[model samples]
Each structure stands twice: as structure tokens, then as C-alpha cells.
Target: MAKGKEARVMIILECTTCIRKSENQKSPGISRYISQKNRHNTPSRLELKKFCPYCYKHTIHVEIKK
Candidate 1:
């Protein structure tokens, strides 16, 4: 059986840049999906994919201490 507390994560989504825009916004696609599922389902420990704002792509992520 698995042990220890489940790692907390900050789901950072990809950022979009436009010539007419000065700032980029984080995408909500992955965050919404993960949050929705986590709300209604049992929790489990596993590596997950999250969109990176800086990278502008889906990237594998591990928990980091703030």
C-alpha cells in the first residue's frame, strides 16, 4: 500500500502571447479537468500532466515545496 501524504500541486497552464496583447493568461483546460475529477473521485498518487505557461505546452510535473 502507498504511504505518506499526497503531494499538493499548482496546475500552471500554457500561456498565450499576441502582438496586440501585453500579458499572457494561464489556460484553464487542464486545471478545470483535474479539479473537477479530484472533487468527485477518490484521490490517488501519480505523476500528472499540466500545461506550462512559460513553455506553452503540456508538461510532466512533480510536486514542489513553496
Candidate 2:
């Protein structure tokens, strides 16, 4: 038996708000999250509501190139 390409792929999610205001950020780094998704299920960029410690609030985390 042979297996083809993996359907589940690892993706990096970064806070949309943080990236825009990197210069104004008090923290040293921008908040990011690690997660997986099914390629066939979500062909478009994945976005989820996640908590950003730096921003101290829930923000839209969008998929970014690993």
C-alpha cells in the first residue's frame, strides 16, 4: 500500500492586530498559534478567534506561511 500527500497540514496562526502595530507593541514578540487543518476541507486561508496574551484580548488569527 502507498499513501499519497498528507491531508492534514501544520499551519502558523498570527494575530492580525499585532502585526499591524508591531512598533507600538510593548511585548518583545507578536502572538502566534500552532494548529493543523485538512487541506481538502479548507482550501482557503484559515482564520480563528484566539486569545493574544500580548494584546490581552481575543483577536482574529490568520494563517501564515511556515
Q: Report every candidate's CA lDDT.
A: 0.39, 0.91
- Candidate 1, lDDT over the whole model: 0.39
Please list the residue runs of candidate 1 whose C-alpha ends up more than 4 Å from where it truly belongs after superposition. Answer: 1-46
Per-residue lDDT tens digits for candidate 1, residues 1-66, read 994644544332222222113345543333212332232242443345766554565666543223
The runs of at least 3 residues in candidate 2 whose Cα sits more than 4 Å from the true structure, single-residue gaps closed, are 23-27
The TM-score values for the models, in the order shown, are 0.30, 0.88
Candidate 1 pairs with clashing backbones:
none
Kindly provide the TM-score of model 1 when superposed on the true structure, using C-alpha atoms: 0.30
Best candidate, lDDT: 2
* Stretch of 10 with least lDDT, candidate 1: 12-21
RMSD of each predicted structure: 9.7, 1.6
- Look at candidate 2 and give me any clashing residue pairs: none
What C-alpha lDDT, on a 0 to 100 scale, does residue 41 get in candidate 2?
96
